[model samples]
Target chain A: MQVRCPHCASVFPSDRAGTQFCPRCGAQIHVPEEGQVVEAGLPPFAPGAPPEPSGAEGPGPGEGPTPALPPGVREPTPWERRRELGLFKAVVETWKASVLSPRRFWPSVRPEAPWTEALLYGWLIGAVTSIASIPLRVWQQRRSVDELREAAERLEELPARLRDILRPIVESAGAGTTGDVVAQAILGALLWPVGFIILAAVLHLCCLLVGASRGGFGATARAVGYAWGPMVILYLPFIGWLGWVYAAVLAAWGVKELHETTWERAVGAVVIPFVVVCCFACCLGMAGVGAAFSSLRASP
Target chain B: MHLHLPPRNRTFGFVDALGVTGAVGLAIARWVPVARIVPFWGCVLREQTGWPCLGCGLTRAADRFAHGDFIGALQANPLGAVAAAFFALCVVASALHLAFGVPLPEVRLSPREARGARWALVVAVVLNYAFVVVQTRFPHLLA
Candidate 1:
């Protein structure tokens, strides 16, 4: 039977009798989606395109479990539809746009975009999180030794793991401030990966909400990893560069193969070399242009 | 998030820049005997009573791991050693995908699973922080 939502006036078919709120208008009437206890959210562009009316009308080709939208939702730009499922996200697409191509750090600051916010926020959050954990830690510390042990035991493997992280800090705290800073640094590195993901995601979602950009956790991680992940590791001895190089090259290839990439592995091969060459050509062109412009003089 | 990727020099952006920096930083630190760097940092950490820490040898660990010495990497820091292994796997899988027309490596989670995983990770971290604090204050019982 077709249920008409009194609010937004959208009429979609319901498999059962009773209905609830009109999703279109936020009105809570007595209508629901057939027998569905929970239903999917309405589509983004679904204002006009209602679901198939009741049974008398007919079943639509892409009805019921709505047909998947073409992988790329952008306008009429035609691209091949991969025969296999992608590896999680269109990682290759994201990689190409964000990591490989360079300009992809949208919504977030650009390389040249002032570092004011990021640096300030990073430091502030780092310090705050560090200080905040102190009391929480202290309260737990107050518990009986046996109780704490039991809790730690119950925790499986995480206590020792977490203790290893705080050892230097705790040991140093017996002394003074220098140790505190070191403690913070150690803590910062340990926590940054997880915290950064959340921060980046929030920033990205805000961007999307405002029609500013599609930045998200994945993109932010890639960007931060690209810019700072290496720099942080740069403090290491001789082999530090090796890690950075490895990460860099891997990131590059990943970006090149992001789009139309399958979860299987071979598609990346086809994409990388082509991208590498294309990348090389673009570099030469940029250099050539730079040289030409730098030596500019009137034809006279 | 909507990210605006400005133009970048592939030859010298993060990957390239970090490589050069790491090589130079390592060389300089090694040669300079700088009193304010990693080893020094380690010494200073030692001076402290050591509340406990996870990444004690991470920098060195990453250094060693990067050089293809998995054992050396572990010596520096086991966690970093693990991370290095994951990175290597990612590289091999990605490289193969790039070199041939193979599909990409299996992504760990679908969008739904991923969303769920993220929140779980956050909870784990907070709990970890609490665990560390408690352990530092009372080590014997757990130890």
Candidate 2:
């Protein structure tokens, strides 16, 4: 008997009449007996014809306005369809959805689209943010330099160790010219693609370690690329770090939706690597302290 | 495992994008004095805590590897050397795949194999960290 999955609309033949998993997407479904199929509003299966998605019919009654995708199916983002909608509109729409409504947006974003398209979207955001924020960053740097100088001058009253610690920061902050800051901004912006790829590789490795990378590296890469949407407003000084936090949140959501995994696994995949790095650093720091103490004692 | 040949007209994929970006980053690192222009303060972990971080010599390793000093890169950071070599491999693989339509071989591991690989990775990272610590702190032992 032919059974049509109400979720993804994929039709397949089932010999038995019980619960089984969908062949295409691995989703669980119930197989009804002959003439027992009673899914409302779902189209009947026609052999040799491509399965039509219920999303084409729009949301049913009592459903929310957001066109939520069914499990195991995804549509292309506005950015991926830029040829059809003009580039500017696509970029805006994609950015809006990614930053404002990631839960709805990420599930709908087709993970299998060419990764370069996603990287291009991220690069565009990074480049624009860097270019637009150059003056602001330069102004901030100048202000910080003055503040550091003031703090450095008052450091003599503090403990000797504290003074020693802050002196390098003050010196480093005061040393850079505005031209260097501008150059740094430009170069940092240009390196976004490489940085995103490297980040995705690390995150994907973490995902694999945590058993959350069911959708493969392409999906992870796409998620990381689109997660940069929040960084569009990284120019805002006080709220800039908040935007970064939101970007990380969106990345977690992206992994969850793209990989069709539980929230726990997704969050673990993102957080575990950083935690490991921190712990490793702490251990190394302790070892270094030990070595320093031993060397000091030996010298005497 | 079975081999899956990609379609003739494949779109730009993860490896391809990674290859392009990694190659560009390496090229810039090779030619440009990025470290000098950026005014990077040395690592805070090393400076304040009297310890070398896990990524202590990664920059020097990348710099050395960019100039074809493989042994020097390994001496600096074994993992960094491995990563540099992987990036170089990606460049070559991406070129062949993009230009000649040659598909990269896909390896699929079973659940048991994947578990083993994960453990192996953890062991490798720990071993590499030990190497980094000894090389940085007790150089005489290595010598």
Candidate 3:
């Protein structure tokens, strides 16, 4: 039987009964059995439809009156104040829920959550991940030492001029000690707030450019901060890329939910910045290659 | 029964294209001696752990495989040659799918088969690393 997705309005055949997510857009859909009454008040499927006005503009069906906040004071969110459940427990729970079900989680979040709390969460996750990577970092340092020793042995066989030229470079590269690793971890944790602020600003600008800035800068910042929940898995080898992708997905979903914007707008806001960064990296890489070639050609 | 799902987003196609471009670039670099003159960015994992990670030496191994040194490629990392071949197939498959709307068959593996595949991959990685260790520590055995 053919089923029309209520979210994207894409029609696809579904043989199985009951609730299933639309493959096209990952929206939840429920298919009823024969003679069953279709759910009432469900939004009708409309292709390329503009998003409905949020409760902030007008009271939508079943939506309550929008809450008012005093100037310069942001209300604490449940996720931020779950101290009764213990701080670590609350953080882990929040991270798990946000990462696993971002669509549902983000929509439920109060727009008034302080950006500072979000930044702290992001920093804490970064610090935890860095600490988790200590064992791997130590092993890597040991391997580096062995390689340096081997290189030194080989360097002894080279001519005096060649040896003199390469020795200093090799020595500098092999200078990573355990103290360096600890310092890097501390620095990474401390600098995470800066990264979060920059990311939030970029995304907020993108949202404004895309005409989806409904909840203001604070809302966007909060969304960006909470969306970094997936960074908890940054210590995992090989699969760490998954954490980055998941974080991006969460950020897009969070933006959409908090702004009450369409999926297209949210995705555009998230992905445009990423595409720009990639293009910039590619250009820099090409410039570097050109410079190297020029230097190689100029050398005697 | 096979379930045919909806077509994925063009972003996935773009990502696949990038992967194909990189693999093809690396393959071409194998034949060009000038490419070999580029500075080596040694693996961070290998430098830290005193052992090669799963992806260590993949570029060089792929280059060797492209130059018809299958044994050397295997010695460098068996997983690298396999991954190169797999990715090469993916490039062709993705191109065909994108251009002609040809759908690739989705193989649904049984639990046993999935477990077996995972174990096989683990074995390949372990055996490859063991070979590397032996070659590095006791060169005369391989010689």
Which portions of model 1 miss their true places by more than 4 Å?
A1-300, B1-40, B43-46, B108-143
lDDT of 3 by residue, A138-200 (tens): 777778778997898898776565565457657876887888877887788777765666577
Candidate RMSDs in order: 24.7, 10.6, 19.8
Stronger candidate by lDDT (1 vs 2): 2
How high is each candidate's TM-score? 0.27, 0.66, 0.46
Residues B63-127, candidate 3, lDDT per residue (tens digit)?
87777787777777777777665656766765766767665443333334434544666688788
Using lDDT, rank the candidates from best to worst.
2, 3, 1
For model 2, the superposed segments whose C-alpha errors exceed 4 Å read: A1-73, A81-89, A148-172, A175-191, A272-300, B2-11, B18-64, B75-77, B99-101, B130-143
For candidate 1, what is the DockQ? Answer: 0.02
Give me the candidate number with maximum DockQ: 2
lDDT of 1 by residue, A70-109 (tens): 2111210001111242432332333343334432222112
In candidate 2, the residue pairs with backbone N, CA or C atoms under 3 Å apart (3 or more residues apart, or in different chains) clash, namely none
| CA lDDT for candidate 2 | 0.71
After aligning candidate 3 to the native by TM-score, how far in Å is the CA of B29 from where it should be? Answer: 37
| Highest-lDDT candidate | 2
For candidate 2, write residues A260-283 as lDDT tens digits: 666887898888766876776665
